[model samples]
Target: MSRRVRLALLTPALLGLGGLFAWAIAGLPEFGDYRGPYGYVLNQIVVPLRHSTNVVMGTTFDVRGLDTMGEEFILYAAVVGVTLLLRDESGAGRVERRTRRARSDTVRLLGVLMIGVGLLVGLWLVAFGYITPGGGFPGGVVLAGAIVVLYLVGSHRDYGPFRNEHALDPFEGLGAGGYVITGLAALALGLQFLTNLFGYGKAGTLLSAGSIGILNAASGIAVTVAMLLLFAEFLETYVVPLEPEDVGS
Candidate 1:
């Protein structure tokens, strides 16, 4: 289309989106102070009905599970597209470039500490997702952050051991596939898709949210893998030399 015509069509759409976004933001409660009826109701009922202390997780992984599945696949589809379009172009197996490594002891020490903290926090988020504020999504990103720390601190040679598709691909597959299998299993049992099938253990415990917690952990894995894979794809020329097997795959 002509530039004028494109602008004419885009202008109204942009205005409409901006207006809606403003409206939504304006309606949000101030931080640390929420009194919405939905929140109140969820606070009361989530633990009793879903046996999950985190109402957000109960809503996401159980009550609105099918929707969450759709969201997870959205990431899956996006990652697949990135892999297909960019993986071939990376050519990490065919070429190697001079790499830069951190030389400062102070920087390395700080990065190592951050990596440790990120790992601990990420695992904690997934472990207590149903009982606390965080869930799979945030936890996955934190884990990815740890990987990023290792990358930032290590020499290209130092990162060699951890920088391959084989090291990262399995988590992506299991995470994406696990979510679907759980839902399908529910169908096999004639229960609602993504139903909370596993027994709800005592609330406020690690095992409390049943399928909800499982889904959260799976999501964390998928997200962590997805993000790391993206990093690998983009940093192929910067990362360690890929193995001969990687070139064929």
Candidate 2:
């Protein structure tokens, strides 16, 4: 329809959403209110139950894992939608073109160095997510950022492991699927879905939080692969003109 009509409709919708948000916010306890019931439960119930020192991680990947699963599926759906909508179906192969501006050797060397460091740090965060402040989400972002650095330095193609788009595609699915499988396995064992089914080890150690560690690693993999896939798609985008015969058909 007309732009004016669209704007009129959108204005009320925005206002309605804002009103609902404000109403919800108004119901929240005052800032710095430790006397709130939610805080007490978080400190006493959730943290001890998960055996996790990182309260945020415990809440996200364990206490509210079902909610997190919904969020993950939304992200997965968005990536799939983007891929389908932007699919290259013109049948013309990718056109090669040289960059107008070249990066300096120093930048390239730095990218190589950072890639190793990023990978190490990302894995460390995922592995230690149970005990530490950082988790899979941030670690995954770091890993993706490292790949982006490689792209900036024009070394994406030279990286053999991440070079193949098809190969990387499965990782997104695998990571997400692994998470669901873990939950389902718990269900099969008569435990609640996404429950901390495994034994909680020494509270402060790496292997302490049982399934939280697995979930964190899974989340890291999923986020890293999804981000990389999106980057590859946007980078290699090209337009193909339709042939006259095909257009007519």
Candidate 3:
């Protein structure tokens, strides 16, 4: 389509999106407003009822999980859209991509050190998300970053394994679908969708919050996959691989 036609279609869509956002934002309580009983109820009940200290996680994954599931679908859909847009359309050869090697041993060493540290922290975040301050989304980002840093430090050979579209895309789709599946699992037991169906486990532990923990994990995986794909695209599009002789230069 011509640019003019594209813009004509896009303009109304942007306006409609803006209007919807405005309508949603308009309903939120103003600053300092504690006008609803829900917040009070969650604070009072989440710990005792859900066996989780982080009331936020309980609210996000159980009390109002459907909203979070919708958000996950939005992100999953975006990744799918990007993958489609970036795919070779004409049955063409692979796009030539370049990897940049770090110019100094110190930088490379630091990157290597950080990889281990980051991996540990990311795993911790995902594992304890339901019990603590972190959750799947943030933890997933950290995990993706740790992996992407392999390429950032010029380990193209190592990064190549992660670059497989066949694996990453499906995993992300599964991660996205995982949340819905977890929600639907409740149906098998005659409970409502997204209910905290299993035992709440011990509070303040890795096993707490029943399906809240599971949902957090699902969101984490989805987020990690989405971020990895996006970072791969950015690298492929913009970074050119340096010559072997340029490795330490």
* TM-score of every candidate relative to the true structure: 0.79, 0.80, 0.80
Q: After superposition, how far is residue 84 of candidate 1 from its true place, in Å?
A: 2.3
lDDT of 1 by residue, 149-177 (tens): 88888755566645678978888889989
Over 4 Å off, model 1: 1-38, 89-93, 237-249
Query: Where does model 2 exceed 4 Å of error?
Result: 1-30, 96-103, 159-163, 238-249
Please give, for residues 89-207, the per-residue lDDT of candidate 2 as tens digits. Answer: 99456764233222577877887898789888888787777788788888888888887776566633354356467899789878899889989999999989987878878777886
Rank by TM-score, descending?
3, 2, 1
Q: What is the C-alpha lDDT of each candidate?
A: 0.83, 0.78, 0.83
Where in model 3 is the C-alpha error above 4 Å?
1-33, 91-100, 239-249
For residues 1-249, write the lDDT of model 3, one tens digit per residue. Answer: 999999999999999999999999899988898788889989999999998788888888888899999988888788778777776667454545545567799988999998989988998888888788888888999999998888888666668867776788778878888898998889878988887888988899877888898889889999998888877665554555567875654
Local lDDT at 229 for model 3? 81
Worst 10 residues of 3 by lDDT: 91-100
Clashes found in each candidate (C-alpha, N, C closer than 3 A): 0, 0, 3
